[model samples]
Target: MSYDELKSVLVSLGIPEDDISPEASREEVGLDSIAVVELALVLRREKGVDVTEEEIGGTLTVADVAALVGARTPA
Candidate 1:
């Protein structure tokens, strides 16, 4: 999952596309606790990425989340 892909997922989750950037914080992009969980489920179920909410929740910025997903994503 690249940064753009993760940003698209965030957009689908109702986050404003303009609010998302590589340096943007998760909270700044409206990624609350519930959103974190939903993102995890969406990634796993829809994108077939095996990421957990805890992992996503631990991230600080959008880049961090993208890196986590990219790391877990198979090439």
Candidate 2:
């Protein structure tokens, strides 16, 4: 998926779309630890993709998170 599409999903989760960018830092996404967990869980259940905490912990950009989800998504 495109980065823009992934960023839009984050935006829909209450994170400002503008706050998301391939270059933006993870902190810029404003997702607290709980929020991160919540998002990972949401992606797993809704998209049939499993994103673990370790993956979330290593993500620094919105694109990274999206990449992780995309990698785990069924083909």
Candidate 3:
């Protein structure tokens, strides 16, 4: 999906619109283990996607998370 679409998803996750940049890292934006896991759960429930810590990739920013979600392969 496009970055803009990803940004909206990020915002829905409580991440600010300004924080949805490509330069930010998961940790940089406070994606702690708890939050990450919570997000993974949301992904699963909302999109039927399974995201693992290992599958998080080297994604940095909220935009990166969006890209990751978009990149998720169908089961």
The reply for model 1, stretches above 4 Å from the true place, is none
- Residue 15 lDDT in candidate 2: 90
Instruction: Please give the range of 10 consecutive residues that has the lowest summed lDDT in model 3.
Output: 1-10
lDDT of 2: 0.75
Task: By TM-score, rank the candidates, best first.
Answer: 1, 2, 3
The stretch of ten residues in a row with the least summed lDDT in candidate 2 is 1-10
RMSD of each: 0.6, 1.5, 2.7
Error of 3 at 10 (Å): 2.2
Ranking by lDDT: 1, 2, 3
Best model number under TM-score: 1
Which stretches of model 2 miss by more than 4 angstroms? none
- The CA lDDT of each predicted structure is 0.94, 0.75, 0.69
Report backbone clashes per prediction.
0, 0, 1
Candidate 1 lands at a TM-score of 0.96
* Model 2 deviation from native, Cα RMSD in Å: 1.5
- Relative to the unseen true structure, what is the Cα RMSD of model 1? 0.6
**Model 3, residue 8: displacement in angstroms?**
2.2
Residue-wise C-alpha lDDT for candidate 1, range 1-75, written one tens digit per residue: 899999999999999999999999999999999999999999999998999999999999999999999999877
Candidate 1 displacement at residue 11 in angstroms: 0.5
